[model samples]
Target chain A: MSILKVNNLSVSFKQYTSGLRQTTHQVISNLNIELVSGEILAVVGASGSGKSLLAHAILGILPLNAETSGQITYDGEVLTSKRQEQLRGKEIALVPQSVSYLNPLMRVGSQVRSSVRKRNAKQAQEEVFQRYHLKKEVGNMYPFQLSGGMARRVLVSTAMVSGASVIIADEPTPGLDKVVIEEALNNFREFADQGCAVMLISHDIESALKIADKVAVFYEGTVLEVAPVEDFEGKGDRLRHPYTQALWRALPQNDFTWIEGSI
Target chain B: MRWQLTWNIVTFLFWKAIKMASLLVAISFISFLLVKNSPIDPIQAYVGADMLNVSQEQREKIEEYWGLNQPVMEQFMSWSSAVLSGDLGTSMIFRLPVSEVIGERFLNSIALMSVAWVLSGVIGFSIGILAAMNTGTWIDRMIKWYCYTLASTPTFWMGLLLLIVFAVWLNWFPVGMGVPAGVLAEDVTIMDRIKHLILPALTLSIIGVANVALHTRQKLIEVLSSDYVVFARARGEKGFTLFWRHGLRNIALPAITLQFAAFSELFGGAVLAEQVFSYPGLGQATVEAGLRGDIPLLLGLVLFSAIFVFVGNVIADLIYRVVDPRTREGKSYAVKQ
Candidate 1:
């Protein structure tokens, strides 16, 4: 069953192009996607493809200068700003892209614990930290004291500890090593297996496919194709869109072809 | 690791103390030069009406009594030794020990400055938060206008305007002085002292409020837009809960640093405000000492103020360590690793 749905969504920002001149740039236009229980929907795109904007829209954390028009629903109810506020961190949690998102002033342990509203916060935090391969002492450290990999693990642990039904993890594995990356992906896979939905936003479609049940190909601020994970196996034969086929072939293990401008 | 970190911090504080001592010595020597080289004749300034009546020999004797007859280096050495021996010498204007006069004046000044410091910090920080939360609205614009106007205002002119409006026009508070004349000192109540204090304190605080408010507002705006704060909001934090947890803690370090940076400005304003009101505080004494060529009293006030500002800065640094983990733990931990 679908836990979250976005229909005919559009996101634009009012920015100053030059002195005394303001222009509205549409970042995401008429986009559509859904997140279902017991599934991972990987959003794969190059940078600036509006992948993060979708996450921000779903979380209702877009900047003040943003202008958004969309019908977003969670659990069959319209997710208005007020409704989004109510569900955020309880029913939905976000693992943000940048490691800088961790509060520098707060201890990593306390930061993870603050998100746990239903269960024993300390216990939940400790459990997540242990599972994420973080040393118990790492919890007592501030964000600045953490290595890049440690900070990424802490960000992932914050969402994992929240016990939210929907988790949005964005570009969360860049600084991590192979072993840690696999563990993080496996954690998300296990998290989705417990009848919760996961939206993994990434540029690395290769790693995303290891766990993502369905992959949504993002291009030019919109979803060009969202196919089951199996459909991404072969070359241009199975994939519906030319952009999606091009993306698959462009991977080094495949054709490594260049289409130019589609991305 | 923690033990090593603690030792590093202890060493850091020891070095800071040595630095402060060196700074104080430099400040004192510089102040002595400024006072000694000035055009005013200390004896003439001290004697006032009696200067013409004193014989040349008596004038020489008076100069000898104050060590002014010695070589410049000799004068400085004798003064330094006297200071080392715990004597700040006699005030040429007051005819009493400099320390005693400074103590009495400092009590009154401390009350005025302390009140102004706290009032401005609380008031400025609140308006800053208000403006940040209401950015681009009329409320923010109004607060910005008020802070900018106050920022450009002179403390003395502001004091005079407040005096005219509150004392002359309104007759709500006292016109000047710390106490009402002809009233016995024993009979003066706390309310009387507070009433006299209100104008000068308000003048000093209004000037101080502008810098803190503008800086805090700008900092909070940046903090609110930061990725950490945005992530905090995404985690179901909103309203005062969000602000209390994320907003206040993040902006507090900058706010405090800015507040403490205003310490020198606070003293400068106090001098002007005290002059405008004729308040018998250390600021008034400072001006009196400077103009009357009372080197001992002037030097004493300068040293006292330097210590005062140093203590304030130390307190701010301690608070920063408490409120910000990066300053205390991050650098040391990074070093250890």
Candidate 2:
């Protein structure tokens, strides 16, 4: 069964000014996607490609300015019109791009423990605490005491603790060192192995290629292509679409091939 | 290594406190000595025709008894010695021991200032956190405008307005002063004093609360923008729990430090507000001494005020250390005396 189905989804943000004309900026337009249990879907795009917004719509955590339309079905339930908030921390969990998701004043272990204890079985909670290598006292130490890698681990663990069947992670590896990125990718894989659907949003094509079973390239607030990772190998020139071809070539080749005149 | 560093910090702070205390005492001595060196004598003001017609010997004896006939340096040294020995000398105008007079009034001012301090700190800090949590919304804008207006307006004017509304118009309690006359400490009920105190304390504190609110708002806003606050939000922190538990804990250090500084200011600012309301407090007594040129009384009050400032800052540092233990252990940490 498809864990989550997002059909023809479009989201816009309203901008207002006292004496100036206001406008609506479409952030995500007519986006169609599916996430099945035990699968990893990578959403790849250049910065400002609205990959994060798509994940937010799926998680039902979009900002107030966002006006969303179209159908979103989660776990065979029609997720339309009704607020999608109640599904969060239970049916779905989000790993945001920024590390600021954890309260800085709280200990890493305590926050993560609380996240899972709210919805998790007690046995699973203890297993998670041990798997994360979190000391009992670590839960008492505030966020400032943690390093960047520790923070990322805490965030992922928090999502895992929620016991959501689907986890949406946005740019999980950005600004992290190679070691931290490897750890995060491994953690995502572990979540998928547990029969949970995982959505990895990224701006880096290489990183997306490494872990994604299926890659969805988003451009101009819409999905341009969705294909298996093997399909893109040596087929960059025959991408059939100008935007897709541009994105393929935009990959860092050590020769500085910058895509021009393409959004 | 950490223990050694901590030991060094403690030792450094201990010496620093001693140095500051000695410097303060020396400065007080020098300034008062200069006043004693001045040529003018108060006995001249007291000498009337009856005393003038008296023998020169009697006048000289009178000066001797008052210790005015002593050498300037000797008189200054005696004053300093007495201060060191805990005798602040008798007030020339009030004819009472300066320390005794201050002791009687100190508690009343502290009572007013402490209440105002805690009231403003708690209210302003909470509001600031709330305002920051819902930033960019109407609630945030409302808090911003309210804090801005209160911070800019004069505290005295706010006090007067509160007095007019709560006292003159509403008749909620006694108008001006801490308590009504003939309301003895034993005879007056606790509720009566509280009712009487409500207006002045509220009046004096509102502006302070506003000032604190702005500081707390700014602190919370900065904290919320940090990568960590985003983490908390993602974890499902919402409403008052988010504000108090997450936002408050993060922004508390600065807010608490500001509150401590505000305590010192409370007493200093209370002089005008207290006088306006005819409150029989230390601030009012200090003003009376200033007007009468009561040097001993004035110096005594100034010392007491300085002590309050010093103690306030020390308390603030202690509280900060308690709240954030990392501050005391890190390289960038500030050690308090």
Candidate 3:
């Protein structure tokens, strides 16, 4: 059964124009996807394809000016804003993209521990830190004291200790070295193997294909096709969407070809 | 490493002291130069034009006695050296030591300004947070309008208007002066002093609140939209928890710096408010000293005002260090290397 399901989701922003005039710009439309238990669904798309917006929409953390339509279901129930608030950071957690998302004023350890729902939050946080290769003393350090890799590990640690069943990581591997990227992806794989759902949003198709059980090709705010990981092999024909086939062919190991037109 | 950090702090303070000393000398020299070049004669103002029967010998004697016969540079050197030794020159008009005259009024001004500062800071920050939280709502628009209107109103005019309404029209507060006549300093009740203080304090505080509210509102809005705040909201932190823990904490350092930047304006507003209320504070004394061409007293007041501004800046820097651990960590890291 699907742990999370989004159906025909649309997001538009209302903005004021000259004088009393108003305009609505639809950024995302008719987007649908699902995450099953013990599976990793990676949403792969180019920049400005509204990949991050989908994650934000799922989390119900969109800006006040944004208006969203359609339905998101979690655990077979309609996920309203109230349910989003209730489940967020408990049943569902986000691993944010920007390192600046960590509160500069807060210490690394306590920040992670603050989201722990377990009885032994401290022990859980420290164990997660150890799992992420963060030294015990690094907990006392503020976010500004952390290097790029260490900060990324800290972000992962925060999501891990949240005890949430659904983890949405938005472009978590950009700007990271190979070792850190492998570690982060391995952690997500381990998380999925434990019967929890993971939504990994990324522009890096190569990294997404590494751990993703299923790949959903996103283009122009909508999912073009959702293909199983096995179908991605020797692509072009197995991939249903032309864009996905083009994307697979564009990979350097494949034909290294280029596609025309912007999403 | 600890020793190195200590050494850094000590050297920083020593350098700050040296800079402040040189700044004081430069300010005093410039003030003296302006006073010396002015057409008004301090000695003439001192002796008074009414003393027509006084002879040239007596005038020459008075000039000699006051060391007015000395060249401008010589006079400045003597005055600066005396000031360095903690001796502010005698006031030409008051016929008392400048220090004593300033000392009497300094406390009163500090008391008045302290009250205004604290009141405005609390009220303004609260309103700014509220406005930021309710952005695009009627409450936010109302507060924005109120801040702009209050900020544009002149300090003296606001003081007079408040005086008329609260003191004259309603007879709720004293119209002028810091204290009522025949009220001894030791015998004055807190309530009595508060009644006398309300008008000037209110006038000064209105401007401060308006300025701080506008600045803080803008800053809070920026902070609330910052990446960390968004992340915090995603973490399920809501409302006041999100506001004070993340929003207010991030905006505090900038807000403090902005407050210090507005110190000069605050000082000017305090002076005008004091003048309008006839409050016997340093500001009132400053104007009296300037009008009478009391060169020694005016120079002393100028130096004091400059020192106050410098101290405000130093306090702001200290608060920044306390609020931001990054600054402290950077210092330690630098010292380690």
Index of the highest-lDDT prediction: 1
- Give the docking tier of candidate 1: medium
Cα RMSD (angstroms) for every candidate in the order listed: 2.5, 4.9, 2.2
Off by over 4 Å in 2: A17-21, A80-83, A117-126, A132-137, A250-263, B1-81, B125-146, B161-172, B175-196, B217-244, B251-254, B325-337
Query: Which of 1 and 2 is the better model by DockQ?
Result: 1
Model 2 error, position B71 (Å): 10
For candidate 2, the lDDT comes to 0.75
Model 2 agreement with the true structure over A40-109: per-residue lDDT tens digits: 8998887887887887677665666789998999878887534365666666788877556666556556
Output the lDDT of residue A151, model 2: 63
Cα error, candidate 3, residue A242 (Å): 1.5
For residues A63-85, write the lDDT of model 3, one tens digit per residue.
89999999999999999999999
Pairs in steric clash, model 3: none
TM-score of chain A of 1: 0.95
lDDT (tens digit, per residue) of candidate 3 on B1-337:
4575567567767887788889988899998899889987876777777568778898889889878899988988888889989898889878999999899888889888888887787788878878988999999999999999998899999999999999999999988998887777898788887888888998888888887788889988988888888777777888888877888778777777767766677778888999999998989989989888888899999999888888787767766755577875553322221
**By DockQ, is 1 or 3 better?**
1
Residue-by-residue lDDT tens digits, candidate 2, B1-337: 3676668567756975886697668768776875566553555534533555768788788888878888877877788788989999777667899998899788778777777888888999888877877788899999899888987877678778887887889888787766678767678777777876777688677877787788888887787666555444455555577566677677888888888877666886688778777777889888877766677887898888877787777767766655564564342211110
Each candidate structure's TM-score, on Cα atoms with residue i matched to residue i, is 0.93, 0.83, 0.95
Provide the TM-score, chain A, model 3.
0.96
- First chain TM-score in every candidate? 0.95, 0.89, 0.96
- For the predicted complex of model 2, DockQ is 0.26
Chain B TM-score list for all models: 0.94, 0.83, 0.92
